[model samples]
Target: MGGLKVLCIAIVLINGQTIGTVAADGPFPDEARRMRSANEFLSPALRAEQADPIRNRGMLWVEQGERLFAQPPPPGGAQSCASCHASPETSMRGVAARLPAVDAESGQLVNLEGRINDCRILRQSLPPLDYETDELLALTAYLTALSIGEPLTVSIDGPASAFYAYGQQLWSERQGQLNVACTQCHDQSVGRKLRGDTISSAVPTGYPAYRLEWQTLGSLHRRLRSCQLGVRAQLFELGSREYLALELYLKSRARRHLIDAPALRR
Candidate 1:
């Protein structure tokens, strides 16, 4: 009799566990199927991190960048970014909303970081900062913060059209040993668990993000390169044309979304 009772309880426990999973991962309601960025999905704790300057690790890097802007290292008699721009809140406001712009000097599309480096070299007579460095990430995060709450607005027409189109193609093209495209994962798997992590929309809005996995801040391009590597695809160099094109395309997709860079991601 005791054995039968134990068996009955086991069955009930198994049924309850199955039901709980089905409830949690059940089919999304029609309204829920409409895609939303991770911003809308942020848990209370995550939201607090974004709101509280002290808790938001990204704020540390932004503050470092702010200090760098006011007192840049001297190389070739370089001047601080603040010398000309003054307070970032005033001088740099809304600047990121118009980025991935065609540089008149290079006739190439340039993101905010590239433009910053361009200024460092041409105006300040300093060498371009290397990609993924602490100072670079800090500065990029700082600039991105200025545009927070502003809508994403990359140029997709005129000279930028060709680059934008190339980016669109790259998104759909299959690569890597798994033969998966970005859309296969980001578009389809969004809001679903993959390898124990929630896949998100490949939005550029909350970039220069502080990823918990990486335990560091990095540019959007850095995140893209990591994904490309994940699928065993050949990686593009940082600031390369391919990456820039893709960045522009990603930003275009999120044009209607608000800028929320330096965001935390699991």
Candidate 2:
């Protein structure tokens, strides 16, 4: 696949049982078929680790996020996130799965991370949180965890149509020194081996995830940036419109796939 020898990896459930082997060299599955989460491509050990909170390092960020959510607004501000939206368990449930949407008030596209900063700047009257910072990652992790099993339902209708179209275009356009596009690996070569790692369907269900390579929780944009670097493409800023549009497209493609934020990945 993609000029590399295909390699099959066991698809294991969290209970440590091998379900099957993904066909590494097979053609892309039909769109009518149900989309698979990237978690299904993980090694058994990593799958088990992701299912166990004690062993999953990503949970630490979720815990920190819970604290930040409950914190009072900085002096002079009137509301904390928790103040506007009560307990996350009740209010934030399923919110992450529908994100990267057009914010009703601002009329701008906002993902989970963008929403958090929006609240900080507009509501709390504070500076926007830096991208990839611990605080931002933590809050994103916590909120995403609330919708762990919710299916993605990001809308591309109305004003969001343009962004979604741009994202789809970016997905297929070739770039970088390798002259590769995202579709080459994530679509055409999915389930194949790349440097000992299985190529997944490029699902975004695992944002704010803890990657073994990074050894810390990171956002989807962070992962996107890494992929650009791997391809030697021009890298966009963390919150750049290009990345945001791409994110919207990914989530839209992943419609109905259950979310697994703070996910564990190799």
Candidate 3:
């Protein structure tokens, strides 16, 4: 083991007055320890499928996303996402890896999905897309795919620190009838066989991914809810603060791991 991983906290000041406390780096795994992507644990056949765009079922959603990105805003709208962001390959590159960030305006955490909906509602003058909708998943998968190979760098500083702490709490706290904590499975039993499936490190980099069990692409929150159900816990609403905070903590654990969105999972 290397040096202890420490949480870095800072105090915000204004005119020599302490305003608030911020955590620059929440409690994270040791820096010297390498965190592997969930893709590394994939079966050879599924790995091959994930690698080949033509063979990957998740790519279908990506394609739909591309079309949706270029689609014009409804009548009377100012511009489409394409009009503002231009080519996603050029403008949107590496964007996904930095999400679940605190929105400056709302001072609330917003993931990639939340950001997209924000654009639609505020800029495009359209209604927010529903969670888990084909349109939302497609667009999210498309943007995430563009960040393939990019390392996760989600921030957990400032107001986000509180949320990160909550997420950390949730990760370690035992819940549900089974009284299972996320750490017991993801951190302690990684690589172990679980009902025919190998446990992963609970990385968020591979979502909105294709899951054979679901037979379709789904968001990280959806998967989280599934885990809750697996342990006989109550499910939280999609896009809820609890899940968003948990997503932030999960991404922080996967810091520097290359993104594998639109990934295939058994």
For lDDT, the strongest prediction is 3
lDDT (tens digit, per residue) of candidate 2 on 1-266? 27866445222112222222222343433541445678779888988887777788888888778877887877777688888889668688889988999877777788988988888888888788998899999999988888777767789999899889999999999999989999888989888888899898888888888999999988898899999999999998999889999999998887766677778888
Q: What are the clashing pairs of model 1?
A: none
**Model 3 pairs in collision:** none
- Which sequence of candidate numbers ranks them by lDDT, best first? 3, 2, 1
**What Cα-based lDDT does every candidate model obtain?**
0.76, 0.81, 0.82
lDDT score at residue 178, model 1, on the 0-100 scale = 73
Stretches off by above 4 angstroms in model 1 are: 1-35, 72-75
lDDT of 1 by residue, 95-201 (tens): 88788989877789999899889889887888889888998999898888877766666778899999999998998899998788998887877888776667877
Q: What is the C-alpha RMSD, rounded to one decimal, of candidate 3?
A: 13.8
- The worst-scoring run of ten residues by lDDT in candidate 3 lies at 12-21
Q: Which parts of model 2 are misplaced by more than 4 Å?
A: 1-34
Tens-digit per-residue lDDT, 128-186, candidate 3: 89988999999999898887767688887888899899999999999999999998999
